[model samples]
Target chain A: MSKIAVIGLGSMGYGMAQSCLRAGHDTWGVDINADAMARFAAEGGRAGALPADLDIAMIVVLNAAQTEAVLFGETGIVADLPKGAVVIACATVPPEFALKMQERCAKAGVLYLDAPISGGSVKAANGQLSIMASGSAQAFAAARPALDATAETVFELGDSAGAGSAMKAVNQLLAGVHIATMAEALTFGMTQGVTPDKFVEVISKCAGSSWMLENRAPHIVDGDYTPRSSVNIWPKDLGIVLDIAKSAQFSAPITAVALQQFVAAAGMGFGGEDDAAVAKVYARNAGLTLPGEDA
Target chain B: MSKIAVIGLGSMGYGMAQSCLRAGHDTWGVDINADAMARFAAEGGRAGALPADLDIAMIVVLNAAQTEAVLFGETGIVADLPKGAVVIACATVPPEFALKMQERCAKAGVLYLDAPISGGSVKAANGQLSIMASGSAQAFAAARPALDATAETVFELGDSAGAGSAMKAVNQLLAGVHIATMAEALTFGMTQGVTPDKFVEVISKCAGSSWMLENRAPHIVDGDYTPRSSVNIWPKDLGIVLDIAKSAQFSAPITAVALQQFVAAAGMGFGGEDDAAVAKVYARNAGLTLPGEDA
Candidate 1:
């Protein structure tokens, strides 16, 4: 069995660490949150220092900065990691940052897989995430055990880094925009006397529907803002997308416009609410109340 | 067989007329374009004026202006229609305008079903279009034969004139925004080294995919913009959406932004190309050549 260390212990990371434990690996769950690490320990996950013989280390932090801090920061794990081990970075980061990380890991005699994950927290817990991965043959080989335990679909995008992250940014661009647009359309329908429920019912069956629409519009219908994926996520993810696009001289007006909606949602103190709460921005603007909101 | 008159034999209308013929209706196909009318005649569609005993006169026109002109204009058909005949108005019009048309048709002793259709020309020709119909019991009854022949799914929105058009506007809001967003995302992928083919292959399977992306992105990959649905359609449809939103005092910034992209596309002389050609706007903006364009 592989000796796996999952750093972060957040929604995605905790679930992934559990998947590794379920697969009979010696799994360690590390996080700044002491309660999370202790809870993992209660569930048969190893706590404390990662083993010197760690076979795979999956970085599931928030973004590039955290990923860099954990891998190359003051108390970095790369220097302690065994040669030939793999670092499966599962954050949504810039392709250039991923390339830089991969190069830094290579110098430490470690393999780095530029793997950005999809499917939400529920899918992560069930070991059904779709991973877009890229790295060397050695990186793929070393990361195989955790991957088998955690992912239902692994898209091996290229033999080197960057391509996987590139695909992830493209996907984030589509996903973030769709959620915001779904909210925009739903609220717009309300002003036309189309109720939230009717909007979900008809649009889901129509050609306008997207995967995100089918998944999230129901939340608006129910007036739930419980953050399966929080509103704050878009500002971070889409910000990364817009950053990359700007660096590439790409004109993503829709993405730029969509980012502003998420930012407005955040400004309105809905950063931690479900992303569907972006509709509330439209609702507030149009002076219309959503399903559960008071008129 | 029902005596059916399908006016406006454009791509969508001619297809609906063909569907009526396929279903054994005694269908009369009419159009200002003599070429389109003659082509329908070549396909066994009946030629000549609509009979006074017409059971269903489907106004498959361009907008509220044409619909108003056809139903109440000089030499309008409502004056010649039999009392019990149904006018199935199949255009994406404002809900208020639909209410006005229903009132006029009622005064003329004709039943009116405010029906707006979805599904592209291919679905129209195959009799698989989705129709959102709202009218009284008698109107529904009178329009039943034509609805059965022309639509696969009839969403009975309400027993009124405006509801069907309201739902159509809602559907259009989502549909038009989705098509433009697909173009935006696909071309954004290109600027980041994601090829058009790879963008389609990966994103379609990822969370970013919408119905428009799955159906239209391949057109970009193959470098074919043969107008399965033209770019010009968006300016018309989304303009209707924005118009309705404006009347409702609704703020639709994303939609307003998306409309600009299509408008820019039209301004760039791609008005006649497929709606997927909106990617060309993004392409030109970023100084990147699309798959089928010369670099």
Candidate 2:
């Protein structure tokens, strides 16, 4: 078993750390929250300092900034990581940012794998996440233990850094827009006398359905806004997408409109709620009450 | 066997007429295009005027105007249709328009089934389309033979006229947004060095995928613009959606945005091409070349 360190014990990272331990790795959990680190240690995660011979350091922070801060801040772990240890970056970051991180890791005699994960926290805990990864041959080899521990599907995109992140951006573009579109459609259906339950029941079988629609629409149907994934995610992830699109002179009008909806949801104080709560933005705008709401 | 007339023998109607014939119905094919009528007659469809004893008159026309014209305009078939015969309207018209048609049909001593179909020409020919249908008990019972002949899945939306059309609008909202968003995302990926083949290869298996993306993105990948469904279909369908939303005072910004993209595509003269050619709007705006396009 390899020695692995998973930094940032958020919903995704904490579960990933548990998966590493379950896979018989000498796993270490590091987080800004002492409670999270202590919780991991109680679950048999190795406490205190990370092993000097760590095989992989997974950065599962929120966005590119947090990822950089975790890897290169004053107390960054890269300085002391072993030469061949791989840093598996599992955040949705810009392709250029991923390339820069790979270069910096390489200069420090460390390997870097650009890995942005899909499937959510439940899958993360179950070791069934899908990983879009690209890196050098050595980097893949070094990161395999954590990958096998955490992911059910690993898409080996290319033998470089940015392809994985680029693919991830493309995915985020669709996924983010799909969730917002699902809300828009569901509420629009409400305006037309199609109830949320009927919307889920029928559309799920129709040509109109998407993975996001199927996964998230039911949450709206139940009026449960508990954040399986929150509304705030789209603004950040789609922000990365639009930023990259701007640099490339790409016009993503649907994505732009979708981002505005998420931003509106956030502005309405539903940022921490499940992304499906985006239907609330539509609900409020159209003067319709969703399921489980005070009509 | 039910005596049936399938009006407006376009791509969808022609196939549906063939399906009805295959199911042993005495089906007539009617269209302004005499060539389509002649073609249907050569394929064993009944020739000459619709039977006076017609049990079902399936109006598979283009829009509300065509549907209305077929039902109640000068020399319209509804006037002569038997009192017990069902009129299955299979066009994508507004829900409110459907209610009006149902009321008119009731006044004419005719039964109305607000039955709008899904799946495309191939499914129509195969007798495997999904039909979103609603009407009174008499209407459904009268329309059963035609529904059985033409549809694989029949969604019995409600025992009323407008619900089927409402559900169809909901489905169309998602369907239309998905196609345009597929184009937007596919072209967005191209700008980031994710080739069309790779985009399809990866995204189809990821959470980003939709039925439209899987079905339509390949058309982009192959650079084929032959209209399985045309770009022009969106402006009309979404136009109906926005019109309905406006009457309800519902704001559908993303759909509004998606509609603009299709309008732009039509503006760019790709209206008659495959709906996937909406990617061309994105390609031109981003200055990115799609597969099979001259770079």
In the order shown, the candidates' DockQ scores are 0.85, 0.90
Residue-wise lDDT of candidate 1 within B1-295, one digit each (tens)?
Answer: 8999999998899999999999999999999999998989899998887876889999999899999999989979999999989999999999999999999999989999999999999999999999999999999999998899989999999999988999998888778888888887788777767888888888889899998889998998999999878999889999999999998899899999999999999999999999989988888888988886888
Model 1: residue B178 alpha-carbon error in angstroms: 1.5
What DockQ class does candidate 1 belong to?
A: high
For residue B49, model 2's alpha carbon misses the true position, in angstroms, by 1.6
Query: What's the CA error at residue B266 for candidate 1, in Å?
Result: 0.8
Model 1 misplaced stretches (Cα beyond 4 Å):
none
What is candidate 2's local distance difference test score? 0.93
- Tell me each candidate's TM-score: 0.99, 0.99
Q: What do the candidate models score in CA lDDT, each in turn?
A: 0.92, 0.93
Worst 10 residues of 2 chain A by lDDT: A46-55
Q: lDDT tens digits, residues B1-295, model 2?
A: 9899999898899999999999999999999998899999999997698877899999999899999999989989999988888999999999889999999999989999999999988999999999999999999999999999999999999988889999998888899999999988888887778889999999999999999999999999898999988999999999999999999999999999999989999999999999999999999998888888899
Clashing pairs in 1: none
Top model by lDDT, which number? 2
